[model samples]
Target: MKRILLAALGAISLSACAQAPGGGQAPGATASAPVAKPTVAAAQAKAGTPDARAIEAVRVLNPKVKVERVGAAPMPGFREAIVAGQVVYVSDDGRYLFLPGSGGALFDVQAQKNLSEDAMNVVRKQLLQTIPRSERIVFAPTNPKYTVSVFTDVECGYCRKLHSDIAEYNRQGIAIEYLAFPRMGIGSDDYKKMVAVWCAPDRRKALTDAKNGRGPTNASCKTSVNQQYDVGRRAGLTGTPMILTAEGVEVGGYLPPAALRQALDKLAAEQAPVATAKPGA
Candidate 1:
């Protein structure tokens, strides 16, 4: 049931940004207050280029899928298109549509995943900003290479293991921002426990101690726990130790600090597409 609700939200988020994929932007949508132009330019770029014929082709196959014109490629002559909230490249003629993923010759599988994140850059940035950094228990480095938002549960073994390795992860230049997501659901004991931690005088310390099996102060007040859980749900997070990379890599479970850094570096490299020389001679 949770999965179904999440899928529905995902669809709605995409449809809300009819011109943009995953609600990054809408057609002719402008801010009422003064905003930077770079933000505007990025929104326009990420919205992609719409191919009416290609969209028609997709609709002819599956009428349920939504299509949007995102943009062109780093390499010329190829217009990037998004179908059903996934990234794909289409020829200038709009006759050939290329679906990117693993197990295919035409598209790079890892690159496809990266492309998905690329298309969602604006959405991730906006979501990140919506949550105030001060509200999070931040484990940061002096010069952090990458930062991740982690949705965690106190009783989960993996979450405990992840907390134990905090020093190692920080040493590897990976900062962690913790969000509460009690697996027992809202209004449960676990949920109340999390609320107590957030309502504590020192949220960061309370979280650390709670993960370490220390008791938290019993307190109650308005908090971001509910809102954070909602965000986690929207991001498709289930269970504990769900991590969101600064570059929009979303994954469940725990990863060792070194492995986590390598994963992030790989994601970064894929996102930064370099021009490759074509064979003509």
Candidate 2:
């Protein structure tokens, strides 16, 4: 099961990388800034706790890189730090930093579980929730059995294909909440088009038209396109049609309606609460 899961995720990641235009950075690319390093005294003051120490270790490597959050990792003697939306582990004593591929991932051999990916899933879930449903362009069924958030680009081919099948997905009881993620960056034509779509009187129709190559009508409004793009970036989106489960798990890239429904059903089953019987019964 672990191997199958990893293979599926790997294929999806590759697909996303290939679909992204303008050679956008990989998922979880570090967002660097021209920030100055903390003084020794300041670092010392904040290094009393394990979280601070872990954060300090990452800062010591490159002050320009942002360290968003730090917490205890599932691995013993290490702390998980969310640096620029990527998960990196630092030694509890602030000596070592374990990047995903560099030093290998944290896995539970006994349980066949990838702890590192689990941590990242939590981060994705939290970051995704920060954008409320009101801010998104939603295409949902009257009664949805599953709702998936998608980071989408207006001009991406795969994204358009997914949108074309939007009705099929809705028929399959899958609600799709679309968030703008213009691969060409903010202020680009793609961004403008998405803004137009979001600003349209009927976003669902406007989005469908745009996806079908009708082009968005000329209009402007105070839309959340920029904010949604930022959130997608922080959530490690590398391409359009980046589908994420309600629990923030990246099942894979574009899937046919039936395949998508199957995947969602499997996920639902896995996440369902297990029934426990009363001892006396």
* Cα lDDT of model 2 by residue, 1-281, tens digit: 34432333233223333443667676888978865422222234354776787777656555666667666687789877666656677777776666664224554433445566678789889988888898888999999999999998879998988988889999999999999998999888888998999898888888888988896846778988888899888777766788998788887778888899999999889889999999999
Report the number of the highest-TM-score candidate: 2
Clashing pairs in 2: none
**What TM-score does candidate 1 get on C-alpha atoms?**
0.57
TM-score of each: 0.57, 0.65
Global lDDT of model 2: 0.76
Residue-level lDDT tens digits of model 1 in 134-208: 778788889989889998988899999998999999999999999888888888888888999989888778888
